[model samples]
Target chain A: MQSIIAVSELSKVYASGFQALKSIDLDIRPGEIFALLGPNGAGKTTLISIICGIVNASTGGVTVAGHDIRRDYRVTRAMIGLVPQELTTDAFESVWNTVSFSRGLFGKPANPRYIEKVLKTLSLWDKKDDRIMTLSGGMKRRVLIAKALSHEPRILFLDEPTAGVDVELRQAMWEVVRSLRDSGVTIILTTHYIEEAEDMADRIGVINNGELILVEDKNELMRKLGRKQLTLQLHDPLDTIPDKLSAYGLELAAGGVELIYTYDTQGEPTGITALLGELQQAGIRFKDLNTTQRSLQEIFVSLVKKPA
Target chain B: MNFYAIRAIYLFEMARTGRTLLQSVVSPVISTCLYFVVFGGAIGSRITAIDGVTYGAFIVPGLIMLSLLMQSITNASFGIYFPKFTGTIYELLSAPVSYVEIVLGYVGASATKSLILSFIILATAGLFVPLQIAHPLWMLLFLVLTAVTFSLFGFIIGLWADGFEKLQIIPLLIITPLAFLGGTFYSIEMLPPVWQTVTLFNPLVYLISGFRWSFYESSDVGVGVSLAMATLFLATCLVVVWWIFRTGYRLKT
Candidate 1:
């Protein structure tokens, strides 16, 4: 599929000389949830701001729906809806007015029906006439999402949409994002939560220190980097492992009452049967065994922990 | 053209004024009425007339111009500054609306506000003293041009200010002083020869002179020169605004 948003060689240098983004090239497939996973100060907001036309890029360019962001900003920006991380809103304005205001700002004609539907979708219909300052944190976040969707944008950039939200609201927001994706609105979210990307993204990109270190299919990334561990509860504690068992690279654990074996999840045959045979020849007995795979969180930690 | 966007911004700002009626409308109106009581009643009793117009009527144009300059700048500056302070400017910047539409929406609303207030003051002044508009059309022209010019200047101040204190610095320290010394209360002729020349350097003099001329057919400078000066200031403000948008100063990055 042709990409809906393309960022090529994009870099930003602030007046104070801080480089917020290195050369980042990304092509977001239409209708896919592309989660950008990064830690604090990793340039996620900067990248999103540049794409949404809030920030000027120091070098290179971006295109949305085949139009240059600078040359055809009206067309490009009209196609994008951004839910910024901060819960900034007009404290005095009613929810309905603010959302409608956003719609008009995108050059869209007045459509109270559409605004009503969006508010209802976000469970904000009851609070439509209420001032934004009267709402709770979670409701304000919903208001942001409603405003972003007001213009019926084809692409939505959600920058840390769930930050500071409770677990329940976070789950509900994830459902909303999923439904938006189902409706053919391309989603590009940036989050520090590994579980959020694991649960919601089709493709995940990891950025750190202004560099995009990795971008891959969510499942593919996990499978390729994932490792499995096998732990055996022994019938008897052993003083040491025999030389024959050394070939399996097994380590006595749990004060010698259990043994652990680590292997690549993608390794052929996993060497499990051969390791068991060697264990039996050594006369070691195990009461039970269990296996576990490394999670996306662990993979993420390892990936970001590397020296820049 | 994004006419809908412009309307959205304009209406949004106007609604804000409605919400803050005490500050936007009532306060300025009350203050101008008090000026009629203090300056027109007390001072006019002593100094009978200037340039053949009663002191009470003479100060009417100046007072209206004073309010127009101050209110136009305040309304427009605060209109744009509050968004920046509250961080809602992200939406404005990210929206598809162009810079021209943004300025038109904000400055247009501000100018409208000053215009309305000017009329209100004019009507109230009628209650205190006999009023005459020598050229109502010219008066309207000066009122609009001055409102828009000051509003544009205020927009620049809003963009340049990073703090609430900075927002007040120009209007309070510079503009208010300039307006007072710019022949708002006394004609430039009342000043000595050297002071009159020095007063000519003040831009507000031309605005007040032209505006006062529209009311009493009396002015310190040629009406044509005053109009040209006002247009020149408006052009300068427009150029500054265009440059701000082109460079993305204090807005984009």
Candidate 2:
């Protein structure tokens, strides 16, 4: 599939000598949900701002839908919709007018039908006549999404769309985002929620210290770095592992009532059978045992923790 | 050239004015009327006339210009500043609309609001004093040019101001004082020779003089020079606004 947005050698340096972004290159595939994961001030917003033309790139270029962003600003911007991190709406304006006006800002001709559809999809149709200031935080967020979608752009950039939202509302927001993807809009979201990226993104990009440190298919990234652990609940307490079992690198915890064995998921044999045989010969008994896999959260923490 | 975008921004701003009618329209009108009551009624009764026109009639142009300069700046500056304050400017910056279109929409709506207020004040002034507009077209010409020019000036202030206090500083401290000292209530001829020369340096003097010229055919400066000064200020504001957008000073990061 062709890339809908291409960013090459992009960098941003603020006037105060703060380097927000180092040289970075990225391609957002057509119709894919690409999640950019980063810690605070990790240049996630800076990158999005540059692509959306809210911030000028100190170096390099960006193209959206085959048009250079700087040279064809209007063309590229018209094809993209950005739901900013801030909930900045006209306080006194009704939801209907605000959303309708946003469409007009894109130079698109007015279409009430399209506006109604976007509002309804976001569950904001009921409050369309209400002033934005009167809406709840979740409802206000939906209004922002409705406004972003009002122009029916093919690319949507949601910056932390689920931040500070309740679980139920986040799920509802995810549903709306999925439906938008089904309609052929390419979505790029920046988020601190590992679970959100783990659940939604087809591809993940992890940024750290102003650099694009890792980018890979979600499942592939997990499978490549994932580890498994077999936690055995021992029948009785033991102060130390037998010398014969020390080679397996097992850890005794819960006052030696539980024993944990860590192993690489990709390695052959896992050594579980030999460890079990040695345990039985040593007259060790287990009450129960269970296996678990590392979550994306853990992989993320480990990846970001490594030195640059 | 994005007319739809411009219309969108312009109408949005105008709608905000409607929502805040008291602040945008009623407040300025009421304040001007008070000036008419005190300066026009009490002083008019005592002094009768200045330069053969009734004191009430003589100050009418200055009064209108006073509100025009302040309203034009207040309306435009607040219009843009509010968006920046709320961070809604990000949506505008990210939109396909060009910088020129954004300025047109904001400045256009602000000027429109000031124009409406000026006319209302004109009609209200007529209610208090028997009035005649010697050059109705020139009155409108000065009215529009001054509104557009000062609206641009207000736009610069909006971009330059980082806080609400800074937003009001120019209109309150700088423009209002200059308007009063620029002969909004009395003529420069009423002042000493040295003071009149110093007052000439105040740009508000030219705006009021030219506007007063349209009403009574009497002014401290030639109508041409007044017009020239207003135009020069307009051109300078345009250049500054252009440079702002070009450099992405405050509008873009």
Candidate 3:
């Protein structure tokens, strides 16, 4: 797939000597949902700001849709849409006017029909005539999304789009995002919610301490680091592991009423067959057994916890 | 040039002025009328006239300049500052519009507002005192040049100010006092020799002098020097604004 956005050796250092981002390089594939996951103050916003042209990068180069960000700002910016982290809208402006004005800012000719479609897609058509300040918080966020989509950008950046949103609204927003992506807009979102990334992202980038520590396909990252636990309810209690099954790494839990076995999914044969035979030979009968795979959240926590 | 983008921002700002009619339009007009009443009515009865023009007519240019300076700064500064305050500036900064286009939209709207106020004040002054324009074209030239110059200055202040209080500081403390002492109500020639020389150092004096000359053909300084000073101030403002956009000072992180 062709890269829609590219960043090479990007870095940002504020006047106060605080380095918000280190030398970083990234490429966003066309027609893909790329999720950038990070903890608080992890430079996710700084990275997004540079690409959106809201903040100047201290050093580096970025190109969007084959146009250099610095040299061809208008061209690059017109190809991108940004739903910023803040809910900033003109209080007195009607929703219709605000969205239409945003389209004009991109130097696009006025198209009321396109504007109407964008508003309707975000479910904000009913409130189009209402002043922005009168809308609910969720409705206001929808308006921001409508404005971002007004110019028919090829790439959209959602910076913590669901940070303060309620669960029902967040799900609704996710549906809207999915539909937008289905219509061919490449979406890049920065979020701390591992579940959100796991559910929606095709690929995930984990940023920590001004660095991107990992970037991989969502499924691959999970399968590579994911571990499984097999829990067995014992038919009878036991004091400890029997000598015959001492080779297997098994533990007694639930006060010896259960046996727990942990193993990597990628490990050799998972050791399940041999372990099961050993348990049977040792006369350790199981009443019930269940297996659970590690969630993406756990993998993320472990990745960020490793010392650089 | 992205004329569409410029028009979008310009219309948005002008729409804001309409929404705040009581504060933007009515307030300035009422305040200037009061200045005409107190100075042109009460003071005119005592002084009669200054430099052959009636007291009411003599101060007309100065009063217009005073309101122009204040309104231009206030309108432009607040026009940009409110977006910064509300955090909507990020949207604009990320838009495809260039810095020059953004400045043109904002400053253009602000200058238009000030010009409208000046004409309204001019009409109000006519109701109280007979008015004459020795150089009608020059009068308009001065009005437009001064409005555009101060509006640009206000754009700089808006970009530089980080707080609401900072927005009002320059117009209230520096520009207002300078206008008052810049011979708005009285000619600097009436001052002592030493004070007259000192008053010449105030830039507002040149603006008021050149503007008054356009109206009554009377000025504290030579008309050519006054026009030159106004142009110089305008050039300086343009340079500062250019630097702000280039360096992204207080605009980009």
Candidate 4:
């Protein structure tokens, strides 16, 4: 499938000699949620800013649709809506006017109906007449989303949209993002929250130290990296594991009251039946057992923790 | 051409003025009126007329030019500077609108605002002293040219400034001093030869001199030179603005 947005060897070196982004090449598929997971100062914001034309790249280029972002800025920018990390707004301006201002700034003709729909979708219709300063922080964030959607953009770049939002609002925002994706708008969000990416993204990209460390489909990443552990509660405590069970790579915990068996989740047979038969022949008894699987959070930690 | 974007920004800036009526309109008009009362009424009572015009009437054009220059700079500088201060400029940087449209919207609103204030001062000057404009069209021309030129200069200042103090430094330390030395109240002819020559170097003198010529048909320099100088300054400002956008100086990282 053709990509809706393409980035080729994009890099940015600021005036202060800080390299915010290394050579980054990416393709954003149409109507897919691509979550960029990175720690603070990992260049997520810089990458998005460069693509949105707020920042210029020091090397390489980017193309939105088929046109170069620099050569055809108007066409590319008209197709993108950016929700910046900061909650910046005109405190004195009313909600309606500011959002309307955004639609017009994109060279779109007046469409009060569209603006109304956006505000209503973001749950900001009731506060449309109120000054931005008078609204709550959550409402202010929603206003930012409304402003981004005001132009009916095909691609939405949300930079830490739920950074300081409460859980309830975060869920609501996720619903909004899902619906936007459903309506054929491509979403590329950057977040430090592992759960956010796990729950919302179709594909995830991990960035660390100005480099894109990994990019994979959400389920595929989980399936490939996930490990399972079978922990068995013993009938009695033992000081050491018997030598006969050495092939099983069993680890004794809880003062030898339990045995933990680590294995790949994709491994066939899991060796459980053989291990149980051997334990019974060795006169070992088990009280209870439970299985555990590694979560995306653990997988993420392991990927980012490796030496660059 | 992104005409709709230009109109949107222009209206947004104008609406800001409407919201801050006391500061944007009333305050500047009141302060300029004070100049008329003090210089035109109090001091003019003792000085004789320079040419056929009365001392009180002679300062009207100069005073209007003074206010026009100052207000043009203030309106435009603050208009663009506030967005940078508040971080709302991101929307502008990311929008589909071109730099030309941005300049048109901001400088256009700023020039229109300065023109409005200048006309109000002109109207108020009428009640205090008799007024005559020998070439009304020429007067209007000078008014618009000065407003637009200074407003463009202000846009440059706004882009160059990083802090609020920097925004004020040029308008207060440089532009205000230049306007005063540019023959706002007294004509350059009244100065010593060397001083008059030095005053002639101040570019604002041409703007004020041309504007004064339209009012009383008398000026320190020929109207042709004044108009040429005004156009030259305008062209120079345009070139500088174009370079700023081309280089993305202070606008993009």
The prediction achieving the highest DockQ against the true structure is: 4
**Distance from true location, Cα of A221 in model 4, Å:** 0.2
Query: For each candidate, what TM-score against the reference?
Result: 0.98, 0.96, 0.97, 0.97
Evaluate model 3: give its TM-score: 0.97
lDDT (Cα, tens digit) per residue for candidate 1, span A1-308: 78899999999999999999999999999999999988899898999999999999999899998999999999999999999999999999999999999999999999999999999989999999999999999999999999999999999999999889999989988989999999999999988788889889999999998899999999899888978889999999987877877877888888999898988878898899889988888788989999988888898899999999
Candidate 2 or 1, higher DockQ? 1
What lDDT, from 0 to 1, does candidate 3 have?
A: 0.91
| Model 3 stretches with alpha carbons more than 4 Å out | none
Q: Write the per-residue lDDT of candidate 4 for residues A203-284, one digit (tens) a residue.
A: 9998888889888999988888878889999998878889999999999998899999988867787798899999999989
Each model's Cα RMSD: 1.3, 1.8, 1.4, 1.5
lDDT of each: 0.93, 0.92, 0.91, 0.92
Off by over 4 Å in 2: A233-239, A254-257, A273-288
Worst 10 residues of 2 chain A by lDDT: A116-125
Worst 10-residue lDDT window, candidate 4 chain A: A262-271
Query: Alpha carbon lDDT of residue B115, candidate 1?
Result: 93
Leading candidate by lDDT: 1
lDDT of 4: 0.92
Give the per-residue lDDT digits (tens) of candidate 3, residues B1-253: 9898999999998998999999988998899888888988887778857879999889999999999999999999999999999999988999988899998999999999999999998998899889998998888988998999999999999988999999999999999999999999999998999999999899999999999999999999999998899899899999999999999999898
What are the clashing pairs of model 1? none
Clashes of 2: 0
Docking class of 1: high
Superior by lDDT: candidate 1 or candidate 3: 1
Distance from true position, residue B19, model 2, in Å?
1.0
